[model samples]
Target chain A: MATIADVARLAGVSKSTVSRALSRPEMLLPETVATVQDAAEKLGYVANSAARFLAGGRTGVIALVVPTLDNSFFAPIIGGAQARADAEGRQVTVAVHSFAAGESLTTFGRLARQVDGFIIVAPGGSDDIVRAAATKPAVLVDREIEGMSSAVADTASAFTLVVEHFARTGRRRLVYVGGPGNSWQDAQRTAAVRAAAERVGVSLEVVGPFPPTFAAGAEAARQVRELRPDAVIPYATALGLGIQHVYLVAGETPPVVSSERAIVEALGLAGVPAIDVDGRVLGDVAARLLSQRIQDPSGDPNRVRLSVPVTWGA
Target chain B: MATIADVARLAGVSKSTVSRALSRPEMLLPETVATVQDAAEKLGYVANSAARFLAGGRTGVIALVVPTLDNSFFAPIIGGAQARADAEGRQVTVAVHSFAAGESLTTFGRLARQVDGFIIVAPGGSDDIVRAAATKPAVLVDREIEGMSSAVADTASAFTLVVEHFARTGRRRLVYVGGPGNSWQDAQRTAAVRAAAERVGVSLEVVGPFPPTFAAGAEAARQVRELRPDAVIPYATALGLGIQHVYLVAGETPPVVSSERAIVEALGLAGVPAIDVDGRVLGDVAARLLSQRIQDPSGDPNRVRLSVPVTWGA
Candidate 1:
């Protein structure tokens, strides 16, 4: 049977280099890894994954845990991570915490022993609990923890962009619908919008503690109409659509700025103008940072802060 | 730390019975299992999950692989499996196949050694690929495989209900907007709708092979209007909303039927009537079957066919 040695010989690299290329491609040059992979493929050399797992006591699997899957925000993150992991012949396992008490901790504990590392997205637990349970290589996405590597979106900038758009369009009486009270991004966006609204001298009323669902948006639309905001900024697509539905029914069309393109597209199909906070970049950046951390577990903490690019569409 | 012996003594059961209750509660009477659980809780016994994993050569983690997370259809299934697994002190890991070439097979290969069981939801690949890779205790959802356990929803009945609704309303010129061709449910739904429409003696025009996105729905809406059907049945909520959006824009409203409650609720908030096919039951049943098979891998294969319950709401 063809083996690593044959691939190393064929690729003109040492056997250890070939091993690193297979196991920790992030640590090696892309060209070198590609060459190794090509040679391995040409030789019909398939790595015995089970034998390797037995020898190293590692599962060749990494896990990404999020709070929920009902939202589209987490979909891209999973896609980016899975894409990157698949390129290196690794697999990523996703689990949801559902914000249930002791659930995240239990998941981390069980998977920490089985998988090589973990990437936790928007952990809704105390840092002490996460820190205690995460004994393996780990990275955080959309939230930051002291002494841990993380990748976060520039949410404050996203809100600033939306508020600036409202100002540019001469919109006054702006109402901000908040997301879940426990969400870090929701808190950041609320604070940013309040500051920006004050700077722009527009009347801003922030209302919610909404759970970021379509139903929540439907319920919040009544309050939005009462406030009589000319412009509405909702933290989720479902909420944005709900508010838009309200205006459409009332025969009064108002601008609704959303944080996702999907919401904009859905409303735009009905000729409603909206702004989107580009979240697609979050997943790709988080995946890169996570892969780097996983390849070299003892490396210095690396923080990636991605700016939110705003797009106005009709 | 409390041990199994202490719990067994307190619960007045043998050690083997206590172990069976913990691992495979389906094998024991519900009352006896409840008694054992109560005793364990009273005694403050925390199972050493990691030690048990090492001793049994099992990871204490089950895996669920889906085609994509872009749609909300799979959310309930995930929640059901995760909730059940959590109750038994087990973790459910999720992975996406993305329907790429050999993707499901590769995922199954990588995760097979790391997890004790698997529940693959709506596999997009050939059945042979799935049957080949699934050597561990496994259950299928939304699709069936010969010689394997499966849980499938009754798509035929759902279409019959929608067709009957159309017939009852005396609506003619029915248009059916279809989902992706490769989607098993989409194919099943399309065939069922065609058969039912014929039985109802309605003229049916099926359009699509669309990607089931808002944009695709928007595009399909243009075609739908040209067809000028009195009622339209979209295979998915996105398409139905798209069709509805077109009508609302043209200032000519037509009745649209959707298969999800969320879509119905969103549009119903605008006073539109719609039908919902509950997918919430898929996950719970699949989870239960998977758990049973995992506990008794040598048991007879079980097939569960869930009837679709349709609800019409404003």
Candidate 2:
């Protein structure tokens, strides 16, 4: 491959002159521009992007790692990152740990070299593993490792919204279906559900830590029938489907509190009331945070939380 | 960048000796391997991946390109691809196209060069564009363009199954909520729904090539009320949520048909029978096809379709 020196030698000019000819073509004579272009092409030289990018705002790609794409909860956040990346002309490369089978850690470790930064969603790695990953510019989504920058929604507020919604709907014995025990979102959601119900003077049963899937949702629904909670609020959309299905079958009204805007839109058609979180905005926040880390790798990692509620067709 | 010749000159060996030392090290003399390794490190000569890939069987990364990861329909396919790639000691770099932002073509065009090979969800571009993408070994998912190899699901068969399921429930009037109109899957699905409904002597209304969102599904439901269809069969899980919600609010049952396994699970919890096509299976087939292409680019491109009826809940 052609180096700047090769192009310079071929063009009968200094390396700085060749660089000026390519990057600041307007400042150079037209003849110099032609000579540099020709020589560069002849040597099959493509300018090193990272070296050139050092002086610019930024446009190198970032790797956004998600547990799975199936969950409605994660898609908007991922989408937000892509939109933001595109705006800066930095491409987003998606790497799903869910698909990596058993070699996710190794796979992710390898990706550390390729991306300028990362957006890790509830990375299922340990503290040491996470620390190793943070050597590269990265932002955690819905998770806060001990030392990484993070952007997350306030689950306690999200839970409070659910409890309040249920109380207004005249549901006293409400149930909450939580996500897998390991998920930070699920843990926070679980805490919020328990505490919110107590504060609201409502009887609540926490039925999960279930795997986030439609099957798990169906299983949670069977549990809901047994518990007979006045309404069921699954912590997120993946489980919400099954929870809602059980109530629909029982000819009952079950309200949901979720970050799934898509689900909210779906439920709106059926006149199913819900407390919606603007996941896209969360995604946007997450993107901004990731960009910050990529721009300055030495900064102290910050944790930020924000939320918005959408009560549509209520 | 250090070339093979540069490493050879530094190592006091020929280029052929350096190539053998780096790629087929086991076949080289111990002294030769040590000299080459030392020389490579001294000169900062990491083998160019593209050239090394041609010389060997592995690049340790697999690339996938899809129209959008935000669409739940592709989740299982991506998951399967990721899992398989992970098992094979490969990591995935996915590029998602945002139609809303007019970004797929540009994003994909840029992504194709950075990875070892690509797994394209749709042969989305014009013939010239498709041919350009085809230059890199790739396997298409669920779509078969004129000159590309693909792994397609029997969408026609699946559509027929949905119609059959609807008819079995003694429901005559039906509505088919279509997928993205620009997608080949959508065209095939619409045709199947029409042909199958005609064969079964049933009246069916077709709505949308909409954005494949819950809002689109809900809107279709609103239209369904006007059309007085007995059932609403949507093309995707997000859409299924919409149509199902509309019917639920009306205190009615409109059996849903979708390829979304999540929706099917939700419906099963509600006892709303659904027809599901296994997306994971579709993904697996696509992965194998892409791997085959990468392994033998000079071979004729083969297009294969895999279809299986989903028995609802399971």
Candidate 3:
């Protein structure tokens, strides 16, 4: 087999010099590195990745964990994570907890030390795995896990943004379409919405804490009809897409992905007059937060909370 | 700060035994391994990822390269990759080529040594990257680069499945929607549809070779309306989603996401009586192919082509 030795002989350099040029080219003189490369290319020699890696501790890996993705709110979150990792020149392995506590614990137990760090989207595990993250450079987003640094939109402020959007538009019967009851996020948003209602003097009908899914979003539309709210506000884009599908099929305003529980998505389309909080922003923010914790595990980490104000489409 | 020595002493084993228990763990006795783990857990001692990686070799990272996820077609393929990686206890990093050939080559260069291996989806790069992948343990799925071991589906067969469905539905006038003018997959599917049209004696129209996008699909709707075919088949799921959207909002039965545009994904979601094919199966096939080649690089390599029939879904 033509190996680095062959390239070293051909390029008139010592074997150790060839190894340095091949593995740590930056440590070599430019002409020596170039000559070795030219000889290697001629001989069709490629480095043995495993051997090179064993000599250096660069695994080049990061992991992102999401509890479940059957619900699409995590879609943008996933998208955002991918983009941020791309920017950092790192690759991410994503793990879904399946919303089952036992499965996540087992998944992370095997996974904790494999990657450089983890970006956990709503960890679902027994107390064992949950505690494991505290020892690592872990960061939480959207869902809160104790003893971890988190970057979450302050839902209290977010609900205020949604409610004020309704009032400014002169819509009095503002309805809050809640997410699944089991989610802590649902409770947080619902409470924020109710508090906003008191401040704004609007009849805020808290329609749910329903399943945070498109199918459930369609069902919420049925409730919307019965309540007859002047405006409907669903928490995330995935739920919004479903409710929009119901409204569009029923010949309602702002035609896009939702009518038949999400018909607009069927077309190569973007939402019209959509409220995009930009999950990429959320992801970039989380990456910075997580990287900081990884760099200094002992520091009292800062939590960043943000909410983009909403506005109606023209 | 508690090191492997502490765990080894607690577990009544050598430090080397403790190291072996965590890295290449298959080498250790189960009971001894358990003792070391219990002691480590009790001490709240996390393995320093850097120190342990010296013996473990690579970072356990897998890189997945895709065209772009702006299309629904790419989303499921990514989902398939994620599922397979999770099952095998690996993390995946994704990179997208934004239709810029030179830029993609640069991305591959930056990514080459960083990842353990690559799984490229419809590669868009210079011949150098393709040459690199050929010698390295990289797998190709969906599209083939000349030298790499690839997993591919019979576009002809996938098209046959879609055409047969249209025929059975009594849709006489059929049209094929293609991706942007230069897309290889679109041309392949378009040709297949043409062949099917001649065989079935059905009137077929070729409406596009437009950029495969939702907006592009919506724009194609104007062309389809002029031709007025009873059945529309785009190259893959990307355009199908678009056609379905335009039809739903505009009140027409434009097409499905798999209307030949991205059929593998189209059948999975929205199920609009399209052909369903699994990308995960293709990924596994690709992995096995690459592994065999990596085992012996000089062994005369032959192009492997496999086709799995797709089921028409409602």
Candidate 4:
């Protein structure tokens, strides 16, 4: 309940001096900063973030923008980002904006003025929208735009492992169940699957641009059943689980490969091969990149790609 | 990108007038408000939230504090809160704080200065810890404290349905796998199950102060197997899924009842009866209550308990 005036009065300094001592100590003498800090600690003074923003032009807050939380993929990313931000002494303000063209433009514009920078996880956003939204320092997650900092899980390379596994097992025909149309990760995954299948001389069929939900995966499974490919690869684990359910119900044991390991294990889907992409690591790396970008906005954008591991299930 | 000065210049009014018109229009004359709004619309001026906070005490932001994101139950709650906040023209800032006694005190004190109010989902927090963290207007989810606003899912009542179904099916013994030790919902569910079992003349054994995770559930299942109960009731769906996995792997069929329907279905658990509690609705109601409390901080606290439906799956 102590105010800045109380700290200033106790420390025998002006309120602005107290603010500078707490936020930007290098601008003040060490003795003055120590005196102010001693008074503030005795009074249990917690600086108001909004007032601090006005005084120092830094809110000490980071904005993490994600499209949706409906999918299981995003929760760990958020957790990772929050943990990293907490370690860096910054608060994360999560905004769930549907990045659908013009909608995110306003969200980005409004949030850009409040926080120090952004860590955006908008795989579905177009290049123009993503670029326009970067009015503040930003680090994109799972999406790469020219001259933008990004932290991507290299699932495209991992998809090659899945393809090689299928070929090694003598699976000649394969079906790849795609995810959302606008998703950059989905596009990259599709291309990787296509290129890998061609290299192995395996006949491949790419199916519908599903919405990456369990129900959509089930629908994709029906189409996949008609194709009757030797193996199936899904862009998302939720889609793979849905497809697995349909096959199990039909009394068929079709090989299904997915892009997440935790979900498959959590669901007790035994022997389901997965390309493990640690979303938490991805989020942590993105937050670190965003923090670096915030410190040096004019520095060269760093592009980090985390290697994905393949767990071929028994 | 238009500043307040630009809007004021176009509206033929002072900058203070423009700020008041955009934020607190009721303070100014109708004609003056209309002129400022029209000019602001033409210029595409977006109000800076930090500036608005300095001008008016309200930040137009709500903070949703959750214990952790490791569990699936919290995700829907967050999604629902974000959706409702968006509709009300407010942004949601999600903070994941471990409410382990003294840790959350600082988080609450710091966030209290930044956000207008809070929607806290801290089921694992002690009553004293929760009360101490509520420095701002707060709405508790799934926990009830005296003189505090709360929105709780009535899963306790739904547990009676599970007991009754087990009794009808001629099950003589039941084992209840519990969640976190400090969780009010888990305690309430335990009491309900105990009362129902006593009334139905069925023997029951209680096990675990588990973490409400898949691994913890598997451990609970091992304990329950030793007890050789005829039926099992788990406080969380994740726990139930873990128990189910153990039993399935052991080639034994055990009737497991969970507190979530979506997760059971998503995991392809057939014939698993579940008590369906809509976490999204609970979160929406909590956010709404917090918004109302922010408007009238001195108003009487509102305690809302949402009904939970039973899905007797086949």
Candidate 5:
């Protein structure tokens, strides 16, 4: 129940001075800022974030919006964003939004009014939705919008390495299991893999627009069994795990490659080839981009693409 | 840029009526609420949550606080909490806090002013930290504090089943690997296993206050190898995965029992005995309890302990 007036009186400053000290300390002397902070802490005078937002002041909070947490892929991303945000002296509020077509615009609008800006990880989101949601400063992860900033993993390039490895290992027939049909990353990977397979003169087939889940992977594995490809490339780690489980149960060991090294190692898939995609690094890059975007909204939007390393396992 | 006054004029209602229609629709007639909603939507009117909080109204937002997202165990819990919050017409904001001794109090103090309540999952937190953080309505997960609502899994009793199974299977020596040192759940599990072993006259040894991670499990595995127990009970699935990997690499298949079925199944540990602990259900229960607490802060606190089913695997 401590008031701003009490803090001002205790710190021997005017009301406007107190407000400025709390909201825009960079504009004031460090000693004055320290005095105001000490007084506020002594009296337990927490500034009302809602009032600050109404006054056009920063909330010092960032929103990290993801499609869902069911996929283990997003967990490290969240952790990385949270850690980077903490380092920048900002708090992260994670919002799980499916980004379903009709509801996303409204969700974005409401969320935009609450946080300073956003770090959005919506791989399957359409460009139209991105345009609508871009009303606020946002950095897209694993996807690119025409005029927005993005942090993307070079999975497309990594797929080329996978294809070359398959070809070198005498895996003539190759099948690529795709994830979430609308995913921008999936489209890029598919295109890259197709081009690489054509260059290598290997027979290639594409199957599934399945969800990036273990259960869905099992279903994809069944259809894949009939196709009988010598090498398999799954778009997500969960899909690779599912495919591997089904094959192992049937006592078959078709060559499988994944782009997630952490999950592969944890699951004891030492013999499987994997491309290292550090989600934490991807998250850190996206958050840094978002922080820069928030500070300079009119700056030319930058795109950062990180390299993926492939490990040919034993 | 639509205002409440604009929506009120369009709907032919007072500004106060417009506010009530949006915030407390249950108090108004259904048709009146519909008219106000339609008018607001047509005008693109989004209420400022900060302004609502200034006026002493509910924010309709909940915070789900977890220690960290490094462990895959918390992902499903977050998903379930978000699902339930969406059903209740509330938004979920996830906060990651380490619950370190001195810092958690301040963190909780700031977060308390922003959200309506909290769903806290801090297994390694101390009683003092929980007490200090309980300034707002909070429901504990996997830990019990007196005079507070909690949703806990009965892992203690489940450990008894694990011990009984070890006895029935003619495993004379048992090793129990514990999780975080300060975790209440770990204490409960260790005590239960010790009692059951005593009753069955089986030689038992306790090891590790290790972190609930795969790498830590590998470290614990080294020590367990020295102990040479016939059966191993790891406090977490990640630990079980790590221990299993190390043992399998060395061409040993010691019986490992875990209390997390999802991760075990996903990792293809079909032959490992697992006690089913549905994290989604735990999250749903905790969110439901927190929602109730928010509505009735003066009500008696409730504790709900969910039963864990043991799967004696092949």
Candidate 6:
């Protein structure tokens, strides 16, 4: 609860001197900075980020915007991002855009003035809107806009792994279940799976752009069964679990390849294979990159792509 | 983007009049309130809740505190609550308490100042801490504490239905797999099941205070099989799915009772019966109750309990 004025009075320095030492220490004298820091430490001055934002520009708070909090897809990412931010004395406020067009832009417009930066996860808005909204330091996770820093999973390699497994298992035809059409990850995944299937000389049938739920997956499963694909590739774990359930109910053994280990685990998919994308690691990396960008907003955007490996359960 | 000054000028009123019209309309003259409201709507004065908090006591934002966001148990609840809050033009900020001792109290301390009210879901804190934290307008969801408004699921009736199903099916011994020890719902469900089992003249074996994940369920399944319970009752869908998987892997046929429809649907527990607790409905009701509390902080606390019904899937 100690304020900057309290630290300044304790250090025998002006309020501006203490502010300069904290924000631009390199420009201040070392002795002055050291004295200010010592005084701040003695007073246990945890600078109120919101109050600082009123005088200075940055509030040590960052925002992580996701489509929705209902799925486990964003849970680890959110946990990782918040943990990393908290370690650095920053707080993360999560806002759900709910895959609505222009929702991200609207949320960003409201939050940008308060938070120092943003880490938008799989934004549903158009690239133009995203670019316009991110006036502050911003990092996009699992998607890439033209002018934003991003951390994306290696979808190409993930699909290649799944397709190779299908080929090895003599599954010539595969049905690909997808998520929302506006989803950047879903589009990338579908394109990658299509390219991979062509490379492996297997027929790939793309089913949907569903809401990424078990019910939607079950509904898609009926379509998949009618089409009779030799194997299945679901873009998300939720969809995969749904398809798996429909198959289980019909007492049919259908081969499936999922994109997340969490779904495989949740469905008790032993002997079933999935690509481990590690959303937490992606979230951590994105937070680190965003923090760096917030410190220096002039550089070219940094793009990080984490690799996804196939994991099999016993 | 229209400020209070703009609305006041347009309405031919003072800034304080505009503020009073929005915060406490009852204090203003009816004609003056209508004039201010019309001017505010014309200028599109969507008050920034954070800035409003600094000027006025209430911030149009509410907090939804959950133990963790990872499990599907709270997903629908969160979604429904947010949806309802959004319809009322209130923003809900979610904070994870992680179910650790003192975690809920710490979160309440941090969030209590900025939010107008709180909707705490399945609070893991002790009764004293929970009661102390309700100094502000608050609603406890899925848990009950003395001197606090609450919306709890009828776990006693839910367990009675499950036990009756077991007794009718000729399953004498039922193993109950539980969630975290700190979980309020877990304790209630376990105690209810124990009482119901005695009434039904059936033997009940208690297994866990696990993390309520598939791995925990699988690990508990080993212990469950060793005990050779006639049927399994997992407190959560994730644990139920895990137990179902272990049974499938061992090719063992055991009747299982689950507590969530979403889980049953996700895991395709068609033949397996489950109690449909409808978390979305619970969330909506809790949000409504909390909103009411925020409006009238001095009212006698409202307590609601929704019933859970057992459904046999085909």
Query: What TM-score, computed on C-alpha atoms, does each candidate reach?
Result: 0.78, 0.74, 0.72, 0.79, 0.77, 0.76
lDDT string for model 2 (B82-145, tens) is: 7666544455656564333333243343344345677777624444555565546888787777
The true-versus-predicted C-alpha distance at residue A61 of model 1, in Å, is 4.7
Of candidates 4 and 1, the better by TM-score: 4
Q: Write the per-residue lDDT of candidate 5 for residues A29-142, one digit (tens) a residue.
A: 878877887788798664355444446556566788888776777888888887687556566777777666765244455456567889999887678877677667899999
Clashing pairs in model 2, backbone N/Cα/C closer than 3 A: A99-B82, A99-B83, A270-B245
List of clashing residue pairs for candidate 1: none
Q: How do the residues B25-84 of candidate 3 rate in per-residue lDDT, one tens digit apiece?
A: 556666766677777778755435433432454434566777654444455556666666
Report the error of model 5 at residue A219, Å.
Answer: 6.1
lDDT of 4 by residue, B64-117 (tens): 988887666787898789767765656677888768865625435546656788
Superior by DockQ: candidate 2 or candidate 6:
2
Write down the C-alpha DockQ for each prediction. 0.22, 0.27, 0.21, 0.33, 0.32, 0.23
Worst 10 residues of 2 chain B by lDDT: B98-107
Tell me the lDDT of candidate 5. Answer: 0.78
lDDT of 6 by residue, B1-314 (tens): 57889989999999988767665555667788778877876885533444455455465667787777677678778777876775565666676664455452433444564567888875476777666766579898999877788888886687778877888878898888887887888888888889889998999999888887755766677788888887788877767655655665565665565546655664455655677777788889999999899889999999999987878665
Best-to-worst DockQ order: 4, 5, 2, 6, 1, 3
* Candidates, ranked, lDDT: 4, 5, 6, 1, 2, 3
Residue A133's lDDT within candidate 4 is 80
User: Candidate 6's residue-wise lDDT over A1-314, tens digit each?
Assistant: 68989989999999988777665565677788778877876875532444445345465567788777777778878778976775564667676665456342433444564568889885476787677767789999999877689999887677778877887778898888878888888888888889889988999899887887766776788888887887888877657756765666566665655546654665456756677778788889999999999989998899999998887654
Candidate scoring better on DockQ of 3 and 6: 6
Candidate 4 lDDT over residue span A1-314, tens digit each: 57889999999999999877765565678788778877887886643555555566676778888887766678889889987876565778777776787562543554665678999988886798888888889999999999999999998899878888888888898999998988899899899999999998999999979987655776777889989888889887657756755666566665655546655555456555778778889889999999899889999999999999888553
- TM-score of every candidate's chain A: 0.80, 0.74, 0.69, 0.84, 0.82, 0.81
Which of candidates 2 and 4 reaches a greater DockQ?
Answer: 4
lDDT for B162 in candidate 4 is 89
TM-score of 4: 0.79
